[model samples]
Target chain A: MTARPFHRSQAEMLPERAAPVTTAGVVGWLRANLFSSWANTAFTLIALYLLWLIVPAIADWAYFNADTAGDDRFACKSSGACWAWVDQRIGQFLYGFYAPDQTWRVDLAVVLLIPALAPLLFEGVPFARQLRWFSLAYPVVATFLLVGGIGLEGIPTDKFGGFMLNLTVGLAGIVLSLPIGILLALGRRSRLPIIRILCVGFIEIVRGVPLITLLFVSNIILPIFLPPDVTVDSLIRVIVMVTAFASAYMAEVIRGGLQAIPRGQYEAAQALGLRYWQSMVLIILPQALKISIPGIVNTFIGLFKDTTLVIIIGLFDILGIGNAMVSNPDWLGLATEAYVFIAFFFFIACFSMSRYSIHLEKRLDTERRD
Target chain B: MARNASARRPGSPGWQRLWSDERTRGLIYQLLVILGVALFVAFIVSNTIANLQRAGLASGFGFLFDQAFFDINQRLIDYTSTSTFGRALVVGLLNTVLVSAMGIVAATAIGFVAGVLRLSPNFLLSRLVGAYVEITRNVPVLLQIIFWWVVLSGLPKVRDSLALGDAVFLNNRGVRLPAPLFESGFEWVLAAALAGVVATVFVARWSRRRQNESGERFPVFWSGLALIVGLPALVYWIAGSPVAWDIPKPTRFNFRGGFNVTPELVALWIALSTYTGAFISEIVRAGILSVSKGQTEAAGALGLRPGQTMWLVVIPQAMRVIIPPLTSQYLNLTKNSSLAIAIGYQDLVSIGGTILNQSGQALEVVGIWMVVYLSLSLLTSMFMNWYNRRIALVER
Candidate 1:
């Protein structure tokens, strides 16, 4: 037998076998995900067909034949989207009634925000320790840029009413409401009878009513409760109402996160001799906040969308601007294009935030698993 | 020795110390918060009064009794330009309720069908449903409403309106369908029809209990349907079929005599239902998916058919998950019904807006809106909570 093996035939000298592709590999993935069954195959085909129909039409209307370079409606007659309306009103849409020359200030404010926001969003980045101070500084810087105080000609709040105004309302509400919301959440869970009841009542009442009603009340009823000599700007009233509405929702979301945390964690903090506030700030909040990030982002998206209701109160957010455009004689019957454009703008922002929330959720899940 | 004495002083009463300790500072904090709230409220009231005085506007519900000279395009109750502002508001509220109710029914039906289709074993159907959901949901509802209004406006002129076999007419004005006119003794028939509903509910409960105890299935659905539909028809027949159908006829510029759903109402309804249905569909799909596959497998192993297993085991459980979200969506749809203003549907918000402009009683009008909407929301939530508890799992 050994002699026969030593006489080794070519048949015995085979090459090493290759590995088969996994279900997760490219070709196998396509088969599994897109064509695993007859039903899936049919679904893929139909989806492809529907997409083919829509993609070209959207492209043709939005880009290929769009009047991107036009100054006015007269320049856009290509049987496609007349984006000229957007181009012409872009400034007004951005800064509403803000003086034309003062748009640069708003732009500058946005530029300042990016650097401040970037480090805050990136976990474990340098200056993570400085984030609290940075948060405090942002409002001051943003206020100066927007309100034009201290030798700058003030742009009245009433004049701030468009896409930029929407952003301002949303961001202001988010920033202002968050700390209050956390406190409210804690208060609702507190042993203090009066505080818990008040917090619970506030949250329930606000959450039960629609935001539009709150805005309506702020614009209409809030003034009646004040003294006769005082005056509040419409923009300020809207901001306050939005902040209250958002805080209620945020409180509930944070409360959910708080409830989800293991009781042992709180016990451990108490065992370590941390005071209530200290334990919350150091031990509880970080984990609770991480858990509630998605909820907070969802609230922001809702706030952003709801800012459009300002139009009912006579403020010109993006939706209001679009509504304004439709009545122009030159843009008559062009409602479709204007609505489509605004809808796309809203969709892009909301979708991005939702996707980011999903990513955060996945990351949190991984961390929990580890 | 001094430290030991101080520590032992807690024996005097730890609870009393906790209650009285200045470090806790409960009274001061509570007083501060109350004071802040009161001060803020005082400021707001003063500002409002000043603004109202400056604007030469009076604040009250007095304007509600004033004659509303405006003519609403649609009204559930009889109203003309001579109606009081209060009456106009009532009409508007009814319209809002009407549209919202119709929208909820249509949306739930469409949502359930689409949601199940999205999970269909049939490939094309599922993809189509998925695409519908994604496209509809991703777009802002305001845009969809506007789009529908525009498209409806683009239809052929009223003179050359799109006619469905000379019976139904679609025009810029509205879609006209045949209206039923009740003749003499129709009230008795209506009473009998209502009686049928009461009977059906009783029978359904009894049959359900019977089935539960005996494990014998009853055709409760068909029986309920027959009682509701067939019994009503029988009553109508016994009352000499008192109702007559009035078909709409095209006039020079509009259709006449039949019930017409205005373009504004149609557009609002379609937009709201379709947009809301997309979200509801997702909720439904998620609810179904939440039911563990093991339950289905167990049912199958017990020799139950797929359909029977899904209905008997899965859906009852899935419904508990679905109803809560469904309630939220319903509330959302009701709130979004306010969007009717954008398209000129005379909903509560629109009418309130009109009242605001006409009377400059923005404060009062806004207050009424808050109360109405908040009450509506509270009522819905209470009802849903009760229903949820009734269906909730009773874990042993």
Candidate 2:
């Protein structure tokens, strides 16, 4: 029976059938995606030539001719980037003039943060439920470690100057803005007209102006509104303004999440005899916030990048510190080098946040589909 | 509004809701919020006045009339150190608008082209576009501004400027280019061009109506373009070519007679366009992708050529998804133009910062900033919304 069947179709039993010239393997893929037409071929060639020109120059600058481990700019003067400058002042770039001995405090804060944040960020991590308490306590503990108050030797606001300061602003803004943003989102959706109007006004006004102007309010104008007995320092005021700015953005993001929820869910919660707060806390917010994770992270990234604006008001974030370093007589013309180093710092932070957000999006997407 | 079935009429005792009622609680909460807000604002205001008094700084717009001793490097209008502070601000505002408006046009052009390329059926080219987007978006734009500033400023000195033919020169100082000096009677050509544009719109409308009524497709695009270009040229010839070129000539240290654009402006423009273009490209890619493959298949089934399908079937649908985000990008570009201050470009924020520091009228300066920015935002959003409605989906 097998012999009869094999003989029935000679073509099937013969050697493997050949795919068409234009539809088989890598060559076919190249023809289909890159060189199917004259326009596409020309584009491919042009892009290849461009890469040829740029890649070599960048590689030569960043690697081939790049100097490392030396502190002297005079010793490393090439047509390429002066990476040696970056190596010499890495500490200043990271800590921004925080007393050298106090660098450990900054390290401690970061060390504590990893475990606290990991559970929340990764679903597969162990003891995520119990770790929620760690997440809640992290901000206070980190802040105390950073600024040094109550028990530790206090690092004055002025001494807080570098990339460490950027972290401070970003973390404070992220943590503070989350709750304020949720409240604002709920307020905007409130049945009460006044509350809705107030929320809308705050969101619009804050959103309308640029963040630099808001920082100006914190730097130059906030003290004018404070009582004589109350002394609010620059860092605290800037944090407050940063938090406000972040909340406006986060509010809009959460509002989008709230809007995506079907009307049936709200009705179902009401039918269950849940009060407004109860319905929101127990039902609406959880689902809405779950969907909003990507958006919230996106806002956080924006807030982190925006810490650079603090430099406009003369605060020394990482970039500000880099700028200050370049102004040194020792590194006279190394602005390009210093700025490149600073850019790498930002690129890593932003890239990872964006990647994590995308990962969460994909993970959540499958769960939703199921 | 109808009363709930379980509730009594307003006149009855049961009609009066309990304190536990949600509506009553909501009202009470709103009342408390309003009161708290009012009290907070009053407190801030009182403290501000007390502080202002202690500082002995007069709060007024009259400072705007005072002579601005500060010299503006780049001025579109006639101004000097003696110009009023208000005038300097006007110049600064004009500078800001000029950059943002021109930056918007350039960014949109670059973004659209890059976006189209990002979706090209080419692998390497698409990857190149992807790399561009990732690199631009990942690094802080401020760093880009600084990098570009250094690059432009590192150009040769004025005496050793890079000459591109005779009309343009690039140097550390600026790029000088030949400016068009419109002679007398040039306005007629401009008028003709405007008339041609108006006529083209009418013809397009007429063609569309005819196609709708009789299924007769007119050759509108080509003929309209010819009319617009040819009509203006014909008028220019009739008017004896009334325009002159003010070519810059090389002097000992610099070029003379032509216009100069500063390195600051160039750096800011390039950085802003490149940065904003990255985001715009993503929007464009998403817009194009949102049009499902079935759309193109359906177009093919209906006997539309590839190009026609692109124009008629694909682009129209894609634009619906594109424009709202595009409006926000425009708003963002305008706001981010505030970064122009970092590079010493005299934008509104920069000018305001100057006035604030010089006059120390923090309250008034901040107020002006709020008002101008808020108004600009409102007007832009309103215009975008109106445009959206005009082109929104209309069901049959």
Candidate 3:
């Protein structure tokens, strides 16, 4: 036999002895992750110290010592937090000044939103193609339910407030801005120079300025520009301005998607004797929109958050309702509680949307890879 | 004969040919758009004129020169209620610039630290940082501003100020800090600092050249730090340390005379920094992740330390990914500063609102706001683009 250059473990495989304590299991993980070096040890200790300092205090204030129920400040005897104010005004926070009896309409509309969004946000749902028709008509039905149309009792726009108003403005803007945004995106890339310039100019100007300024324009300047006898509803005006602002941003996002389409794809469509719009609708836009779903969702989240800006112009969204509640004599000095409550609502809405977008991105990425 | 009849001829009628022609269709479409736009503009102009006349509101910008009767709580420049509306607006703009600049600096610092720490080997630290990013980002910034405002305003009363080592004070009113009273010869110390910066730059260049030539590595960081600190110190000592402290002292009701940071500024500054910092941190994390793991392994194989690998191999590549989004975040922070109005921080939009109400020149005031913001956005984007181009990778 040839002499072995290296020794080999040939004694019954050494009975498969376990790894040493220092290099195995929990101790090994700790050594590798948290105390691999002096700096890492220090970082871990500092993090622990910081958590020790902050977490308990926050937990105590927000939960352990907190007053969770009551009607007013007197009910909150604890020094931690006065959540009683939030508890008392939860209705106003949810439905604003809407008549309590009519809140069922708002509730129904909100419930319908799930089905309306399901077909768009997910794949493989039952009868998704048929459900899209409901999605298309859902916006109108929801509006009618909330606003009181042909068959329902009349509810003026002024009466709209609270979280309901936020959903209204955000959903309406999302639905309305898309078509306009698509057109603007096409316009910006059109063969006609004037259309491109006009589209570019509108987008830049709107994006450069804050939403507050546009709201101000709608509040004060829009009236001056309209005909003397033609008075538009304030909520409608807000919706119009919001749509304009959102469409500008949306157009940019869609344009990014449009630009990403390979020249070969356009050529392929053209070679098949398709008209411009037909090619866009049948081939390009479907792929482009799928690619831009994450961006569109992000824009929607931004628009949803921006609905709070209407408070600055004197319309009471959820934040406005919270602010107004805080200023009430019975709830004075409860701004923290009010803001926290409103922030929690917004956080839930925005965070879930972001999470969904990330999930969709991953799914789309896998699909593309496949 | 049928095919010939169906086929378009060169002698076809002009109207029919023009109708069918793509180029002519485009031209006609553009002309219609122009005409429609002109008519719309004319209608708006006519209605606006009629409305202005009807309301008896003057439309000129002359109101800018009129006295602003309202008191601005946080003016960076010299201003009183008697100051012109223009001066008040200038004060507002300066305040906005101050908050935005400070917020940007603080946000960047926090963002970089949190981002790196979040990717640390220590699981607790990373999770903590992740939580911070998610919670802060998901919350609306307006609510944060108001929350901070309320928290700051709910601090101990002026009489029971929270003192910090006898130099800083905090109360419901705001933070009070000792102001530096600069005397003569401080300019010499400033000059020394400037000279030290120049010298450090030169030394860095020299060291780089030396390294390239002879494979020598200089202690550039320590030497640069020494130069910057030592020169300033020497000058300060020679100039007799011409700076005195003006520490705030508690009086009957409020702190007496040092420097006062109003609650509005404090609240707005803190909220903007924290909120924007969360976003910036995510951008930084993404950028760092975009730099492949192969880079770190390669640096290790080349015998570079972990720190050196991060600084030299990873960060340079990461910066390219970080910068563009970072620029947008900066812009977002600047624009979000307009929300300062919500908490009475008296930024440009707030001041403009007051001016609009007082002067009734809504159009001009809004016009000024649009122009100013547009220019600010343009200038920031231009500067950031230049910086981005300078650091971009040179492809082979």
Candidate 4:
């Protein structure tokens, strides 16, 4: 067969021209996105009206007319928000009935967390490989920092309340649950009948009941169960309950990740003559855990939010403190301001964690990325 | 070289071979685990017995039959302060079920609307829905409930109560809606409604078969709707309309005549629905996204309408992803009903807490809570599992 002639390439190109006003500019964007059709135009108007109605009022209430200088109950008498009340009582809500002297311990606990956790979370951080070990010691250090025993004066668990207690329980729960979750996940997958059943039973039962019921059990029934001589701190008991609950959810998530791993990866470990634990630690867990990081963080978000449920158990978590602040004799009828502040606090925590988790998920997307 | 086939093996294997043999190792590990767990359990049991003995607290569920001696403000069942603890618990459980069931319906409706809007072709609608979801999702649900409570309580007094055509009344006390008071022939009307539902199913099946075999179109949805509505109304008319309206009236102190729904229930219901809806929208969005774009294109190429493409192709695949997580959301809503305790809503846990304090049967009360909650969880999951199986893909 005869060959076809080759096409020649142009050395240069004509200057680029702007697109027509109907299709390329701001007007075009509005046309294409907001007012493309009758339905779209109607929707745009409805959305705009809703925004117009709500946005200014909320902004006005939150900032402009908000009373920021006074501390009296009627600071909000003019129908605006009472930021003044929040300003006066911020410390009380943040720390609850915590000892004023030992408040620095709470600050130190928070400050120490960022540095201890940074290396493990981000790339190119100093001592990244070695910092994971610090997570183990961080909780111990924090416990002493809050309760104050070994080298410092005792503050007691009763003093641990508000956002301080929430952080303590939330952080400790996440850290403690991870390793326990891994073992339970493995046990559920094991061929051994008893271990599998035990792991399954624990996960199912823990997940079935609400955390409030568990908190009640921990606050009341746990003491009845334990020996009279051994006295566990209330905060410690709450932490254990919270940790056990989180571990069940974590196990389910990690199991999903494990199920996603290829059979060949496991069989290869078996081929290499590695023991079950060694193979899981080296081959299976590393892969499984990497995939599960996002899910684990999601569980952390839920767990942290659920910590506010401790309010029902009479623990002054952030929600509890907020509730307490509103009902204060001095700041009565400031439920709006109190709730708004606590809502923002929780929102910031949950939103940031979720965003970071999404970012990490994108970065760790080895298999899915094209 | 290996152990002789004819030789009898030792009953108890040594540690050296236990490592070499997988089955032996598994068995040994399981045995050790059982022993450890048993010993720890025994220790806890002994400790609990000793502690209970010293504390003078007996741990048995015998108090269930004893009088509750507590009045629940909002109850479905006939419960008095002198009612049995079991009856009080039943009232609590009934309240839990009512709220959770209603919340599920409301949340699902809100969720589906938001989910659909989130993927709207109109950018403004999508963005608005997205913002709504993000704001609702980020904040703690408890705070939302509290906020709603504050807002609802801020409503005007009973004399100045908001009225909707004199059929409903809203005030600080609660919302009062006109309730249907049925007379004698209501049972016949109900029977007619049941027949309508049965006939609609048969009609749907017949329409599907007719369309498949003869390529003829049928107004199945319209007919089904008409039948369901018309049949009950027809029967009611024939029986001289055996239902009377008990309209809510704004009395001096409170609304009277119609059923009153407490503000706590309203606040809890709205908050839970909105909060869970945000989550459900995300789940639905993900489910829809999981079905590839190629699916729609293929359906379009087959000459199916967009609606048909959705119902026949995309939704079927999306449902596989949606159902499992939807079940979890349902379970979450059910569990969250316990949050009613915060606002002094008489849920099981709250009532149980009262029983525990009054009777000093903390252990037994806690056990009751566990059993009831666990049973609920099992039932919900079992039902979901069955439904999931029914709708699951048949690869073969």
lDDT of 3 by residue, A93-125 (tens): 899888889999999999999898899889989
Output the TM-score of candidate 3. Answer: 0.94
The TM-score obtained by model 2 is 0.95
Q: Candidate 1 at B287: error in angstroms? A: 2.1
Where in model 4 is the C-alpha error above 4 Å? A1-15, A127-136, A366-370, B5-14, B55-58, B211-217
In terms of docking quality, how is candidate 4 classified?
Answer: medium
| Best-first order by DockQ | 2, 3, 4, 1
Task: Return the lDDT, model 3, position A140.
Answer: 87
lDDT of each: 0.83, 0.87, 0.90, 0.86
Best by DockQ: 2
Error of 4 at B326 (Å): 0.4
* Candidate 2 chain A lDDT trough over 10 residues, lowest sum: A1-10
lDDT of 1 by residue, A214-329 (tens): 77777666656665556788888998988998898889889989999899999999999898899999999999989899779978877777778788778998878887888888
lDDT of 4 by residue, A1-370 (tens): 9886665975569698899898988988989998988988998999999999988999989888777877677655655787877666777677877888778888898898987889877878887666777866887888788878878988868777777777888888988899999989998898899999999999999999998889998888777778887778788888899999999999999999999999999999999999888999999998999899878987898888888888877888878888877777888878888888888888888899989998888877955666
Q: For model 2, name the residue pairs that clash.
A: none
Candidate 4: clashing pairs of residues = none
lDDT of 2 by residue, A1-370 (tens): 4564444445545677789878879889989988999999999999999999999999999888877656677778667777777666888888888999889999999888888999988987888887889898898888788889887888888888778888888889988999999999999998899999999999999999888889888777887888767788788888999899999989999998999999999999999999888999999998999899877997898888888888898888888887777778878778877887788888899989999989988988899899
Model 2 misplaced stretches (Cα beyond 4 Å): A1-22, B1-17
- Taking all chains together, the TM-score of candidate 4 against the true structure is 0.94
* Minimal lDDT window, size 10, model 4 chain B: B1-10
Q: Give TM-scores for every candidate, taking all chains together and pairing residue i with residue i.
A: 0.86, 0.95, 0.94, 0.94
Residue-level error in angstroms, candidate 4, position A236:
0.5
Stretch of 10 with least lDDT, candidate 3 chain A? A5-14
